[model samples]
Target: MKLNLKQADTEIQPQWQPIVGYPCPPEFEPSTWVKLWQQPNPYSHDEALLLCQLTEDEWVAWIPDQGETVLYRYQFFQR
Candidate 1:
């Protein structure tokens, strides 16, 4: 799965799903205050970043652009 950075920054789309159930840990903020990936560039789907919110202010993403799971900040994005 790929992540659409532009859409995420502007508005929450249906593609952004709550990471729930067994995949999500109990320690995580109930898998409620977060959203996940959506392919931004169709041509570069494989290279798109996998964005996920850790908390209201803390956001983490698997940034394929930089090739790691690091903090990715974008404008217009809010919890």
Candidate 2:
């Protein structure tokens, strides 16, 4: 099913900071579960908001630090 970010179903918490890195291409999507880097060249990490809005085979997420949204596949992520 398709989901939109403007809807109440997608809520991001204030404590969740944006992950570090530029908006990576879909091909560069993490090969495994990746931690949300709190700082560039991170020595530590923080909880990231995995705001998923499904669109058939793809998913949408927000990156506040970059001020942009990214589309990726849910399967690319793991715990």
Candidate 3:
């Protein structure tokens, strides 16, 4: 479990911003159970994305790709 924040060598707080909104589609109702987490990009350990899990099956990931924040939806495997 190694995190590669280049700035982790320095101060950590100001590097990240608070995610002000949730990117839920119309079918999904917002949940009260929320925890904020920063996960390193699987492809690039040097970067990270702010993510929140909506349910056991779904989550939203926000990335600052370039100068804009891009939103992506991830779904777990269904049985």
Q: Which stretches of candidate 1 lie over 4 Å from their true place?
A: 1-50, 72-79
Give each model's clash number. Answer: 4, 0, 0
What TM-score, over all chains together, does every model reach? Answer: 0.24, 0.27, 0.21
- lDDT per residue as tens, model 2, 11-35: 6666955568866454323223333
For every candidate, C-alpha RMSD to the true structure in Å = 19.2, 19.0, 19.1
Global lDDT of model 2? 0.42
lDDT of 1 by residue, 14-46 (tens): 686676664743433322232234433444223
Relative to the true structure, how large is the alpha-carbon lDDT of every model? 0.40, 0.42, 0.37
Error of 1 at 52 (Å): 1.9
Report the number of the highest-lDDT candidate. 2
Per-residue accuracy of model 3 over 1-79 as CA lDDT, tens digit each:
9988676456556575555696544343232222223334444222323355555555554433422132333312111
